[model samples]
Target: MKPFNTGHEELVHDVAYDFYGRRIATCSSDTTVKVFDRNDSTGEWDLSDSWKAHDASIIKVCWANPEFGKVLATCSHDSTIKVWEENIREKQNSGKRWKRVATITDHKGPIYDLAFSPSHCGLKLASISTDGQFKIHEALDPNAIGSWTNIFETNTLSSAPSRQLQSSFCLSWGKSRFSKEYVVACALEQSYIYQRQENGKYTQTGQLPAHGSIIRDISWAPSIGRGYQLIATACKDGFVRIFKIEEPVTEGGNLQVSLINQFDDHKGDVWRVSWNLTGTILSSAGDDGRVRLWKSTYNKEFQCVGIVSAEQKHDAIED
Candidate 1:
């Protein structure tokens, strides 16, 4: 992988990818989200299109409906999440370039992360903010332009009556094969599982340590069936911890969770951990500026996968 460093001399807050992994979106201190296209022929990503997304640093970008093609949602330090579409009409008709279509501004603080519900849910999306609130939006509205509806909100104070958990530095949704409502993971001192009930209320279903330091990221394991599925929590403690939810048949089917695995290979803070679509391979990146890969096995340890530093690797190879 090549670094498409812009030489902007600013820190990049986050990066996001479309479901297919062919397109990537990165929000930067430069206040813009740059979209890149991965050229399989050369194994290189080319800058395809860009949008001046925010007045301040752009914090995060999420694919709103990747299944529909060229649709995205981005959040920024400007306290807003905007839905954008790409019009590749010129590129499709003339076989040349892709472009961004629209930007819908809706939110109150820096949006840290977002997720579109599984493909089955269509254009629905959920976004979280540093203001300690999470919002769900339709992403697309035919009747009105740049319109959004807030379906859920979390209190900012840990002491609030509605606050089952405190501030969230991260968020993730569980995609279990059996369960219907999506399980939302809130990252903080005491993490919580917010399960959307049929009555339209989110109830705390479970809680975990969430993180040793701050939970920077969380990933849900691909579900198999009615059995227990796992979730990977990436900590600021330089490790990724995996946990499995077990429902005991004896205790009236109560759920029991246990830490199943941990990857303490990173020498620095582990910022994020993502599982491939198949849940077979795992990739992690962190403050060390290194990306490591892990696999599913009884080994119970994550090994060095790939490092992004070319000069460091070249020196090690030469030595």
Candidate 2:
């Protein structure tokens, strides 16, 4: 695989691709977010815009679905999350095409991760932070999408270690409009699922069980055609655990969850787990400096299918 340079003065924390993969957003500990657009003629990625989006290290950057226009959200150690928009992308103007549309600073601790809800879920943003806090903001006005309201907020800290030395908070939105709108977030060693209630409030419906170590990250796979939901979680125990969750068959039914698979191939703290667009394959990044891919076999058993390392001078390795 070919790599493009992201020129940052400090270590880059996250890189996100736009909905159509036409643009890339890279955020760094240097507190700047750079957007690179793919040049159709040259077949190269060119930096189209760069700006200081935060006063502290940017922990994560996520692109909103293109249906919401060219929007990007970044969370930082500044204890804030900013929503940016590039409304003038179709124009050739060289000046920064991106603008900060909204700034959310309701967190008492550094924000670690944020995700935009699926396009059908309306314009919503969910975030988790170091102080065991979680929040979901919605842009209710179709005319003025820049304005946001804090519709849901909660603190997950329950007598756990007050301070964390690493990035431990993360959240992901379930990609289905058929069921209730829900988000899964991690705090301390527990992962909780918050579902939107009939009262227009989100409440914790369930918690994933058997995770004893600190969960570093979590992802909810898109269950496009699947009958059930799959969630992958990476933890400090060096295991990437996959859980199969059954949707509520009846109104107000409880979620049925079972441990489907767990991989210890990382042999160290697994930092992140992400699913492909189709939700057929899963990828986990770890302290091993390698990314491992997992796929389900015909027997419904998950298997490690590939590995990619970022080490210098090392050729690619696969199984």
Candidate 3:
């Protein structure tokens, strides 16, 4: 990937690709969202569009649906999550572009992360905030306007004393191939997964000590006829551990989870770990500003396939 700078005076916190992967979206501390397009023939990236998006640093962004290439979502330290949709062709010709479609303000503190469920209905959204709360929302009417409804809220304050001290930070969702429901994983003091029940409520399915320090990111593996697949979580302690949930049928009919593997390579905090579309390869980025691509094979260890640096240059400014 080529580095396409926007000439902004701040650092970019998050970036993503549109549905077609032809266009890229990035949010920065400068409170602007920029879009770039990849030139097919030349294999070079070019800046196409940009806009002032938030009042503070945009922390994260995710595509609602890449197929339509219509909508995108972003979260910020401004304590809001905003959705933006592209305008029609005619409007774009007249200098009109993407506009804010929705702004969710239920968060009391800065929103750190967000995820759109892969179920395709855009009915469910999961968000986590610095206030140590993870919220789950559902659409009141699937096809109606302003259909979102808050259904579940988990807070460190209301949880047990042991959990109350654990701070909630990262959030992720996994679609169950066995069912239409999606599972939400929140990384915090302890890592846990909540599965959607048939009755429409989310229930805790598994819990584990994610890391020595705060868990930065957690991803669940896709099911391939196995009970429930594994989850990989990154930690500030510089370790990545993989855990698998075991639902072996006991005489009493019970389910259990087991720890599979843990790998320690980085000396600093591991900030993020993402699985590819196929779920076979994993990518991790951290405080060291180095991205490492890992593959699952031979041993339980991760083999770095690629690395990207975010190093800064120290030099005198030109007038």
> 200-241, model 2: which lDDT tens digit per residue?
988887789958688988999988888888999999999999
**Reference-based TM-score of each model:** 0.80, 0.93, 0.82
Native-referenced Cα lDDT, model 3: 0.69
Number of the top candidate by TM-score? 2
lDDT for 215 (candidate 2) = 92
lDDT of 1 by residue, 165-263 (tens): 434466667765466455554535446666666776666666665467768888876765337767777777787887777644652233567787787
lDDT of 3 at 257: 62
Better of 2 and 3 by lDDT: 2
Question: Which lDDT values do the candidates have, in the order given?
Answer: 0.65, 0.87, 0.69
TM-score of predicted model 3?
0.82
Whichever of 1 and 3 has more lDDT, that candidate is: 3
Model 1's number of clashes is: 1
Worst 10 residues of 3 by lDDT: 310-319
Q: Which of the two candidates, 1 or 2, achieves a greater lDDT against the reference?
A: 2
Worst 10 contiguous positions by lDDT, candidate 1? 92-101
